[model samples]
Structures are given as C-alpha cells and as structure tokens.
Target: MTLLEVSDLRAGYGDLQILNGIDLSVNDGEYVTIIGPNGAGKSTLMDSIFGLTDHKGGTVSYDGEDITGLDTEECIRRGMNYVPQDDSIFPTLSVMENLKMGAYTESELSDEKLQDIYSRFPILEERTAQVAETMSGGQRQMLAIGRALISEPDLLILDEPSSGLAPHLVDELFDKIDEINADGTAILIVEQNAEEILNRADRGYLLTEGKMQREEGAEAMLADEEIRQEFLAG
Candidate 1:
C-alpha cells in the first residue's frame, strides 16, 4: 500500500524555485532513497513533502488523504515525521528530555514508546541524562532518529541521516534504519552516500537539476553502467 504519494510537487524558498514537478511515492514498510548531486533539490523534495517550503503547485497525499500545504505539525499529526539534514535536535536538552519533547503532542509520554526507542538505540538509554551536545555525531544522529520514532509515525522522512558520520558509524546507522523499516515504518531518505544507501534501499530516485532523472529498483540502478558512470561515480 502507498503510504505517501507526491505528484507534480513544485516548491521553493521565497522566489527561488527548486523542485520541478517531482513525482514520488513510498509504499508501506518500504525503504526509498533520493540521491543526486549538490543543489539538485533533493532536500527540497523532503521539505516540500513536510510542508516546509513554498508550495507552488501539485498534491501531496498520505494514506489516501490530501496533505498539500499542511504545516509541519499537521503533517506530523497525520502519521508523518521529518528529520532534516542538520539542526534537528535540541543541543541543550538531555537525551531523555529530547525524547519526551518528541511526544509533546501526545497527552503524555507512553512508557512503551520510550522503551521501544531505547531498545532501538541503547546508547540513548545509557545517555538519557547526558546533554545532547556532548554526544558523538553518530549518536546525535541516532538520537534524532529515535526522537522521530517516538511518535510512532507511519512514514519517516530522513534527510542525510548519514552525513558527517564515520564510515563504520554510517554502516551502523544504516543497520538501525533497516531495523526500523523492518518493524514496518516507511522511510523516505535523501542521501549523498549513493552507493551505500542504494545498496540498502528497496528503491531509489536519481534527481538532477530539480527533476527526477530515474526511478528504479535499488539493485538495477546500481548495476546500470550509465547510472554508475554518471551518478554513482564508477
């Protein structure tokens, strides 16, 4: 089932346009990645989906409901969550505090949800009282992801979750993402690490100049000589 669908999505910042009639979808429990060169509107696509950009045209549907132009809170209320590439966490808050803040929309923090997040990220549990600024980059990323998951979103949008992480930490972070998807949360990730992300994703979209160049199964895109030569850096 399609959990999120974006059609002819045109959005930008102020008068500057970025995405141009982009069409994309994420099926329930699927892992989808968007990859492209810098300034290709990859991140803009995420912003548009989360209603953070100026909506010029098109429709965004989630679970068969129209969500176009809805603010971030409305999107989150409708079982969607977004983690941007940077500045997603509160550096002054403790790990536990951040997780609790993620559940602010709820009447109260459910112990079950908190424990589930801790189970997925043990380091977070260990550092519950530690200030977020003191954590490692990978750990902070995990915390960001954990915070998103605290709401039990049906679809999770992640922008560059692996950015600035060590190679080994990137692998670990991807594994955690896989685990989260395995538990049935659909993921839409914008990533710069094309090779690693494509290897792990169920499908991938290659974007260039604010347009989708190709959308294909992960393995097929990885095997395409033209794609490797042009985008994957063969």
Candidate 2:
C-alpha cells in the first residue's frame, strides 16, 4: 500500500517557485531515494510535502488521508517524521534531552521508545549525556536520526542525511538506515551522492530543476550507463 503520495506538487519558499509539478510516492516498508544536484529543488519537494513551504498547487496524501497544506505538526500526527538537512538538533541540549524532545507531542512517552532509538544507534546510547554540538559530525547525524525515530513514525523523510560526513561514515550511516527500513519503517530520502544511496534504495528518482526526469529500480538505474554518466558521475 502507498503510505505517502505527492501528486503534481508545486511549491517554493515564497513568490519564487522551486518545485515544478513534482510527483512522488513511498509505499509501505519501501526505501525510496531522490537524487539531484544542489539546485535541483530536491529539498524543496521534501519541504513542500512536509508542509514547510508555500503550497501553490497539488495534493499530499498520507495513510489514506488528504493532507495537502497541512502544517508540520499535523504531518507528524499523521505518522510522518522529517529530518531536515541542517539544524535538526538543539545544540545546547544533551543527547538524552534531544531524544526526549522528539516525543514532545506524545502524552506518555515511554522508556521503551527511547531505548528503541538508542538500540538502533548505539553511539547515541553511548553518548547519552554528551551535549549535542560537542559530538563529532557523524555522531551528531546519528543523534538527529535517533531523535526522529523517537516518534516511531511510519514514514521517515530524510533530507541530505549524509551531507558533511566522510565517505566511511556515510557508509556507516547508510547501514544504520538500512536497519531502520528493515524494521518496517518506510524511508524517503534525498541525496546528492546518487550512486551510494541508489545502491541501497529500493527505487530511485532523478530530479532536475524541480521535476522528476526518471524513475527506475535502484539497481537498474545504477547499471544504466547514460544515467551514471549524466547524473551519478558527478
């Protein structure tokens, strides 16, 4: 079943439009990745679906409900969680505090939920009391992802989750993400590192100038010479 769907989405920051009629979907327990360069509006499409941008047109449906133009809180209420590219964590907060904050909306945040996140990212459990900003870049990303998982969302949307990490750390992060998806949470991620992410994703979409240029199976896209030379070669 389709857990989330965005049809003919058109949105941007303000008067300036960034995404132009983008359509995307993530099925239950599926791992989907969107690839594009810096200015391809990949992030814009994410923001639009998560209700962070101006919705000029289109519909965003999640879990059989029409959530078009819904706010972030409503989006979360509908079983969707988002981790943005930057400033996802509170710099001054301790690791534990940051994780607790993720479930601020929950009336009864359980220890089991927290433990589940820690178990998924062991480094987060190891650095439980460390201040978020004091951790290394890779650790910080782990904390960010851990915080998002505290909500136990059905769909986790990640924007450039591996932007600043070293190549080795990026591989480690992707491994953790694979574990997350294997545990039954659907993933919709956007990244510039096309080949790396595509290798792990179930399906891949190539977006350019805010429009989807191609949608193909992850392995098939990686094997296509033209796609590799035109997009992944960068």
Top-lDDT structure, candidate number: 1
User: How high a TM-score does candidate 1 get?
Assistant: 0.98
- What TM-score, computed on C-alpha atoms, does each candidate reach? 0.98, 0.97
> Candidate 1, residues 1-234: lDDT per residue as tens digits?
999999999999999999899999999999999988999999889989999999999999999999999988888899989999975899999999999989977988899999999899999989999999999999999999999988899899999988888888988999999999998999999987898899999999999999998999999999999988988889
lDDT of candidate model 1 versus the reference: 0.92
lDDT of each: 0.92, 0.90
Find the 10 residues in a row with the least total lDDT in model 1.
100-109
Off by over 4 Å in 2: none
- Where does model 1 exceed 4 Å of error? none
lDDT of 2 by residue, 25-85 (tens): 9999999999877799988888888889998998899998999988888888889999999
